[model samples]
Target chain A: MLRIEDLRVEIGGKAVLQNVNLHIPAGETHILFGPNGSGKTSLMLTIMGYSNYKVTRGRITFKGEDITYLPIHERARLGIGVSFQRPPTINGLSLRKMVEICSSDREANVDHLAEQVNLSSFLERDVNANLSGGEIKRSELLQLSAQQPDLVLLDEPESGVDLENIALLGESINALLNRGVKRSGSDVHKGMMQKRSKSALVITHTGHILDYITADRGQVLNNGVMQCSQNAREILKWIREYGYQECMTCTN
Target chain B: MYKLDSNGEVNPKDFSTEAESHDYIEDLAQIDGSDTAEFENVGVETDDSNRSATFILKDLSVVHCKSKQEGIEVLKITEAMDKYDWLKDYMWKDISPEKDIYTQQASESPGEGFFIRAEKGVVSKRPVQTCLHISKEGFAQNVHNIVIVEEGAELHVIAGCSTARHAERGLHIGVSEFYVKKGATLKYTMVHDWGEKIFVRPRTVTHVDEGGVYISNYISMKPVGSLQMNPITYLDGKDSIARFNSVLVAAGGTDMDTGSVVVLGAENARAEIISRAITTGGNIIARGSIIGNVPGVRGHLECKGLILNDGLLHAIPELEAHAPNVEMSHEAAVGKIDQREIEYLMARGLDEDEAISTIVRGFLNVDIEGLPPSLVRKLDRVIADTQDDMM
Candidate 1:
């Protein structure tokens, strides 16, 4: 559903992302692996179309449309959603109000999703403010759960939360996928909604996210450069046994 | 119309005399460093011969003083007179002795007068903001203001007054009169800040016609020795509404006596007054009174004070309802800043200054929605400057 080819970006007179290419086909989930200062967050921010990130040479296509120059809110309007690693604390704006503002379909079951992500109690609080780091993560997942987007971006969604909450995050993502299918109960048994695809590109520092959801593909990024793609499970096993340092010999 | 006589009081020049008026104009023209007038084309003149009111009456002796410690008494009177001259003709001629600056300042000459007149059905969207600064010591300022929002007209006025240095005695006597016509709306905001040794007495009154709305927001941030302000609005119109919201902060040897009185005289008239004061190093006495005279009139008064120092703060609220259908209520409180609230903000990584400024700004801020952009910008600056000293 989303494709990036040779994404070269410059920020503050420094190269943050250079010659990076990745593709997530329909119904596929991909994991982006990188260490600190490894351009992982930069790639996410670039994909989100934040200003000040100069895309010198790149082509980002989503749903067969070139959205490289699209504004952030416009891209969001076009069924693109993101969960920031460290979300901002919006003081006066309530969480429920922000969710309603960002979502397209008002008929979506918000209360059930809030209950599923453990954010039912924090529905009245200002967005992400006064919330514990773990609570903030769950709130992010809850907001994401309500958004039936064609493509989703998650940045370190499992960094600060507990294991159980992390599993809940996985379940919420699954629920989001199920909702995006738009199939009735009787038709679901017949796989009538199989034609619909839910795509996502997630960034993870640790392989713990692999424990929650099945990622179809994996790519390692270093200093704004991406290596060859491989199977997610094999890459997970490789990283677990050795580490990202194992790729030092293959610098090319 | 009543007139104040000169008995042991500094006398204003006989402006009723044409020769004296001519000479005064010539002197002001020379002092303003122009042959004619500075803002001659900006406003309307009383007559075709006289210039539009822009010249602020500033005395020569006070302006030439170089010493900073002469005390603010002299400069205060001069500054107040300057504003009075700018507003006089637009206001009424008769003022009570208690509201007269000539009686208060026997030695210093009074300031200018400000008068505003809006014809019927005039809707003014631009807010008028005036700033008065007392730079020298021994300053005495007497300013008089009169505003008339005619039928169906609207206006907003913002005033900021301050002294240059701390610990100087400045004297200020200001009188303001507002007349709101039927279906008109008027909003007024006044901020008072003066150096030490300053004594201020301000008297204000307003009369609302039928179907008129009046909103007054007063803030006292800096008061030197003693500051007394009495603001009143009389609602004589049916279906009229009046509200007074005041925020006062008295610190460091300051003494503030601020009060607001609202009287509902017509049927279905409504009035509300909210007064807040925060004292750190001095004493503050804030009082609010609401009187419902006609049947079916409604009024409420609320006064709150926060005492930061062991300094004394008293809040007295009173309500009077004569008619059976009228409703009146009053509430008053005296306390300190809530520590838990400050601690909560501090826990959010904001410094002490940031948290305090935020709290103060929020406390003083009201819904200024629908106000002009220019006025909002000026109010933001006023908040910033006042927050700087406390935080």
Candidate 2:
């Protein structure tokens, strides 16, 4: 449901990302493995249309409509939702109101969504104000749940999260994507998997998220180049053995 | 107040302190058209059905004055003085008439102001509302007001001051004094909506006895030629509390110099002063000061201002502690809205303008701003009831 063709991006005259071609079809989740400062966030930010991450070349198309230079809110309205790694605190703007804002024209039961992430008591708190790492993750998921975007871009959901909360976060992510009762590699769940239409691009450096959620494809982005597209498990296993250096050398 | 000296102190002398008298009216309900609209703009309830009392003064005339609630008295200043031999002791008692030219003019002027008082143990079911209106061109209106809350009593006052639409280039000086007895609470809210060319000078003083509480909120949104006021309060008895909150906006050609001062004089007394201001193209000087005079007293001062356009915004917060065991602190911040905050809100599907307005509304602690007239009235009642519950 999303397409990026040779996307090159720059920030303040410095090239941060170059020649990144990727696609995530409907009902599929892709895992992006990258090391620190490897432009994984740059790609996500460029796709979200933040002004600072200037798309210098190539184009992005969502649902077959070009959105290379769309404004942030226009893109958000056009069904592109992103989870921020470190969102800013909005004083006096309560979380309940923020969730409503994210819901836009849709009918959002904010209390019900907040209850799913164990954020019911914090609905009155300011957005992202003094929230722990896990709470922030849950709050982001709650907002996304209200938004119900067709495609979700999650950036490092496992980072800074404790072992206990990561599992709950995985469950929340799965629920958000309508992916109940994981693939399990059995013929019985094939019908259930085909009914899922919400696609996602999940970013992770360590691939620890693979233990909880199922992914259809995986791609390695070393420096600013996209390496190879392969089966999700095979890439994770290879990266676990040889690290990102192998992906960088194999990119050429 | 008008000019500035080399010492950086404000000294006002540009306008004349003289106004012609107007005819007196017995019924304020007959007032309509733009005049009534102007009154509503400043939160004045001309229909006194929901108010404990209503008092209106036009130019130098006490047009209409009445009290409807039990244990409350509202009358013209001179009539009140004539009725109570002890009331003369309350007049000009805390706010000395010799302090400034405005106070001296108010003391000597023939204009009639209002006197409102709540008897002991009487809690007001509705706020006492009053308005000081200017309707003549180049008129200078001087008014002196007094408010008293007896022991174990609670009272709320809404005082609105505005010039009529046809009036031009006038001056308004309001001199007010307040007394809160032991075990009493007084909430005072003032709204100013003067015309574009009027000069406003308000001088106020307050005293709170033991176990008494004082809450004051001042708001000025429209444009004015120049305005300056600094009201001071003394928490003289043990365990007294005082709070001052003010919100102001200085548009193009408007100049505002407003502040509040609190003195915690007794043990265990507390005080807090908060002021928020915004300037689009005019100049704004927001000031707040808190002083702790005795051991175990505490005070805090916060002043924040935002400069939206090419104008001046100066914030001065002062804290003083005279005793070693007293605690006093102050915080002042003046700058423009953060760009990152704007984009953060914009990312949530709101256009740029909508995002900025939301942030601005939040910055002003927007409870009663930009609401429909009916909603404003409803919210006012809701807030009143909520405040009652909390108290």
What is the per-residue lDDT of model 1 for residues B178-290, given as tens digits with 9 covering 90 to 100?
88889998887665656656666677778999999998877666545777776778898899999888777777677777888888999999988887777766788888888
A20-46 per-residue lDDT for model 1 (tens digits): 889899888899987678899888878
Residue A97 shift from truth in candidate 2, angstroms: 1.9
Q: Write the per-residue lDDT of candidate 2 for residues B216-279, one digit (tens) a residue.
A: 8887877788888999999998999998878777777888889988989998999988887878
**Can you give the lDDT of residue A155 in candidate 2?**
93
Tens digits of per-residue lDDT, candidate 2, A121-173, equal 99998889999988998988888988888889999999889999899899889
Worst 10 residues of 1 chain B by lDDT: B65-74
lDDT of 2: 0.82
lDDT of 1: 0.64
